[model samples]
Target: MSVTDPEPTVPTRDQVRQAPKVLLHDHLDGGLRPATIIELADEVHHELPAGDAESLGRWFAEAADSGSLVRYLETFDHTVAVMQTGPALTRVARECVEDLVADGVVYAEVRYAPEQHVTQGLTLDEVVAAVQEGFEQATEAAGGRIVVRQLLTAMRHQARSMEIAELSVAWRDRGVAGFDIAGAEAGYPPTRHLDAFEYLQRESSHFTIHAGEAFGLPSIWQAIQWCGADRLGHGVRIVDDITVADDGTVTLGRLAAYVRDMRIPLEMCPASNVQTGAATSIAEHPIGLLTDLRFRVTVNTDNRLMSQTSMTAEMHSLAEAFGYTLTDLRWFTINAMKSAFLPFDERLAIIDEVIKPGYAALAG
Candidate 1:
């Protein structure tokens, strides 16, 4: 699967859909189904930009493709508006799991800021509880095939990071698996939440920070050195510090070398990168270079609804753009499963029993 190889034949949608996948970076608010959004909005008496499901879906895709992050993020306003109640939150979470199961995602960690969903008088703890209940019900309904975990996120520009971090630790044994900081990456750096990061560190809690997406190496450097991030959320800008020589060799700066040597997982979202202007296009994404250099790269759909992407679509695009094989896809899947925030024993069990065997079957 070298970069110079001719583009591989694109896999059919069905073939890609059936291949077992692992997703690490999907957002709960960003992945609501359009039909569900319509129903929920109507129930809450919230007006939407589009009247029907199909038009709403098209509107999201078109708005996200407008080459502006502000425009892209604005679409979430409608989704968050209807998700303020308990029933709506639970229904969305359960349906999200069902959708992932149908798309062949065996393991997924969906993230969201509990603060964003409390506008309708729901407490933060209540919001987390509702989502957890929904996930448990969905897993049971799916016959225990798909495993879902929640990563509680704190809005970076807000001042409630420490509160959210504590809330995440409180729900660790329930359904919450990790903590995260998300929002504008350019103006608000990870260091802004140092108190929250320190509290998480003291509690021995795990967290991944949003860095290197809209910002450059400085943000990534601070996230690693200052905030102590375990993994990078859409850390696409780490490539800025790497220099490729004329002889086709690569050199890494201090920060890049530290990240690679430490094996910090990079949650790279290809289609979302293009939508958010993180990358020019999928073909020019740094994922190919990072994978070739063994950077512990993993693929993800940051926002399935807004980007109009899925785990299968992301994998297919990577295969077509970088000549990836079934073997390559398997490696990426294993990388994500290994980097997940599950307990060590459970994580190893999935890799040994489910993910490895699933990929073996696909290879045959």
Candidate 2:
């Protein structure tokens, strides 16, 4: 209820490992298993900065935590390089699903830029098809447990936004659930791709734009007002618009009020935020404040490998930092599930059948 109130404590690490969580903001390239990355790199003759899986994993964690967005982005260059061919893409995608299933993620939407995977002469369609095939195979192999969806992303600095948006719409009913724009958020505003957003709007396509991460409120304003983003990726800067009065009462600016009033989901990635210099520390994260204020805040792992985090780890950190209880975790999980691009009926079914019962069992 209140931020100062003691939450209903749950053994989150143990319970959450089997609690049927929903992941909404993970990047497929960012979630690659280190061992898989090493093997894939060998297949493509890609020279990795680290030779061993342990060191390679540590290298990613260190590079991302270096507090420079440019350097953090550079790590993806290697992962993306190895993912050029069909088999490589399929293997990574399939393994991603398996990893999520192992982590107790019942439903997940993995986002990746299809354009980035076509460097080896494969078409964009081929990339999407291959990833979809991998997801299907993984789901089957997972014994019908985890449900994975693909969200096609367009690189922010690129000029192919409209093409990627059209591609997302084209594959809407075929495993692709939504569209997104990611990459450097400072100079490349979502407004630069107005044509793509307009096309997606007309096509009734779903989209979540990367905003309020490396940039500030202006980027978020443009993403929501100009580009009509359904959800915000790491909207931590929204806290910039909120202030507290001398008497200790909180005040919301026009932009913060609008976002809260509209119930636009904020995909807040705590560890990733710290890694990207978005937030200095987890204790000072706006997630606790936003959650207290009821802003449709949801936890996510934007880049698992880079941040060296899992959904369970993120939740555990929040619990340790803010003393969140099982109820709080359940609320966040439901919030993410509700905000997902899945059909309303299907989303409700998961909430009612899977998530609710799972959390109830945890509480018991």
Candidate 3:
């Protein structure tokens, strides 16, 4: 008797790379190419921890893997140091688009602090303009293979949230898609930027808050209930509010239930979460539970260079950890596309005509 061959397994790494992706939460400063960083540092006379690209890359990975949010954030200091001029910002932004396109990302929203890049005589508007120029150039260079937008981020500990929020709104028609607050979340909470959040709400602008990663449920509650966040950056800690019993039963607390029921997307970054001590391992990541529970979960590369990852790497790791098929990967992709800050018709077009068809081809 002949036996039917085992059903086709999950797509391979190369196939995953070829699949269309939508990146909702990636950091512009956190994803520069090491070689480019080295060159930029020399131009700006910024001393780097490691002179060579290979060694510098290793240094970032090692420092970020220290399981400390403070330590993980320290790596960005080097990257941001060289990004102080219009030319430097343009170069980084252009290369960011090229890299994402190479990784099969059809659309992405990259965030950075305009305040960080203004030290070298460049105004906040200049910095934003430089980055947008680069994105436009790179998109044209690639023959419009990708669409990249900016999410203006304000450091939570700083006092520029209101200014940055205004900048984001001002540039909304000029390639700026949304606003965000990032930085240490321990003492500095999302509620501290209530004015900015309220302003965005008044202007009817989109904004996400970085919460529930380094902090806990209280942070998540404040972001949603108090601050009215459009999305939760690294909302991995919502898992803490969920309980799994020995009798094979699972339950979610009020906060977690609200997050899931409201369909608020969780920008979960598996590798970066592990590096920041938010998760123990890929197999044990809250994404597994959240996906099983039908939460609005989306995968991302929060800091690609720091985690030594790409969209393909993130998807592949999740697939290996949870035996996810192409369909599963597509589910994550569609979720991200749906949650993007783009217009409804634009998001729907990409999800239907681009993402779904790409995944269908891979599934076959």
Candidate 4:
């Protein structure tokens, strides 16, 4: 079964769903259940483009399918609109974990900007508490089958990174895992929030930056070098720094080589990238080249509702596009678990106890 073994079978959708997966860069607001959104909207008298759950779900996917990143983000207004109150936030977070478990996710770090949820007079701390309550409720209901954590994200366009960073650190021991900065990356560079990053670093805290998605190498360079980001959220544009020669020679630019050598984690969301014009399609995604180059690349569903995806769906798509096998899927899962913001011992426990055994059973 060594060198002469036949090629491994490409995993089917159901098989992939049965395999344990780890997610590291999903958005909380972007993954609300359409039905929940409908009910919550009705409670607040908020208007929706579509009335029924099915139609509203379709609307979110179609609206996000626009190639412009800004346009893709616009679809969140409705989902965020209804998620104003504490109960609404708790419900969404609870259902989010339940959905992940059903999708075979064993571990995940879901992110959200608390600042975006304060429209109805809830303080940022209250928003965090509300979401944590939901996560805790769902985790208990699942009997600890799936481990989930909150990643507080500050809107890059806003000047509240310091506050969000402080909040993340304050709640780190409770349920929050880390901090992040997200929003349109064109005009708002990660460097704009250097004070927050510096403060986090001084406090020995962790954070990831939204970089290299809508922007190019410059954004990624700043996120890593200037801001000291622990991870690069949707660092798809790093491909621009890689050169594939006509004679099959591959050259990595200084920044790209440094990223690879340093073992920086890139949270690549292929479908979301395609939707936001970061990549042409899954077939042409830089994930293939980056994987071949041994970069610390991890797959994620940046927006589940918008991309109409789950961990299983992402793995299935990669299998069809790249002929990934169980072994390949296992590698991606382990990478995400290892790069998780949890303590090393806890991360290792999940990988060895849950991820390794689950994938081994699938492979067997």
Residue-wise C-alpha lDDT for candidate 4, range 1-364, written one tens digit per residue = 1123244888889989999999999999999999999999999999999999999999889889866656676788998999899999999999999999999999999999999999999999999999999999999999989999999999999999999999999999999999999998989999999999999999999999999997999999999999999999989899899999999899999999999999999999999988888889999999999988989989999999999999999999998898888888888899899899999999999998998999878777
Candidate 3 displacement at residue 119 in angstroms: 0.9
Q: TM-scores of all models?
A: 0.97, 0.97, 0.97, 0.98
Stretches off by above 4 angstroms in model 1 are: 1-11
User: Over the stretch 1-364, how does candidate 3's per-residue lDDT look in tens digits?
Assistant: 0023133466789999999998999999999999999999999899999999999999999999987667777899999999999999999999999999999999999999999998889999999999999999999998867888999999999999999999999999999999999988889988999999999999999999999987888899999999999899999999899999999699999999999999999999999988877888999998999998889999999999999999999999988888887888888999999999999999999998999999878766
Report the lDDT of model 1 for residue 265.
Answer: 99
TM-score of 1: 0.97
lDDT of 2 by residue, 31-134 (tens): 99899999999988999999999999999998898877677878999899999999999999999898888888989999999999988999999999999999
TM-score, prediction 4: 0.98
After superposing candidate 4 on the true structure, give the runs of residues whose Cα lies further than 4 Å from its correct spot.
1-7, 68-70
Residues 1-364 of candidate 1 have per-residue lDDT tens digits of: 5344232345566766787889999999999999999999989899989998999999999999998767788899988998999999999999999989998999999999999999989999999999998999999999968889999999999999999999999999998999999998878988999999999999999999999998899999889999999999988898998999999888999888999999999999999999877888899999989998899899999999999999999999988887687777878999999999999898888888888888667656
C-alpha lDDT of residue 279 in model 3: 85
Q: After superposition, how far is residue 183 of candidate 1 from its true place, in Å?
A: 0.7
How much lDDT does each candidate structure score?
A: 0.90, 0.91, 0.92, 0.93
Q: Where is model 3 poorest over a 10-residue stretch in terms of lDDT? A: 1-10
Question: Over all chains combined, what TM-score does candidate 2 have?
Answer: 0.97
- The superposed Cα distance between candidate 3 and the true structure at residue 60, in angstroms, equals 1.1
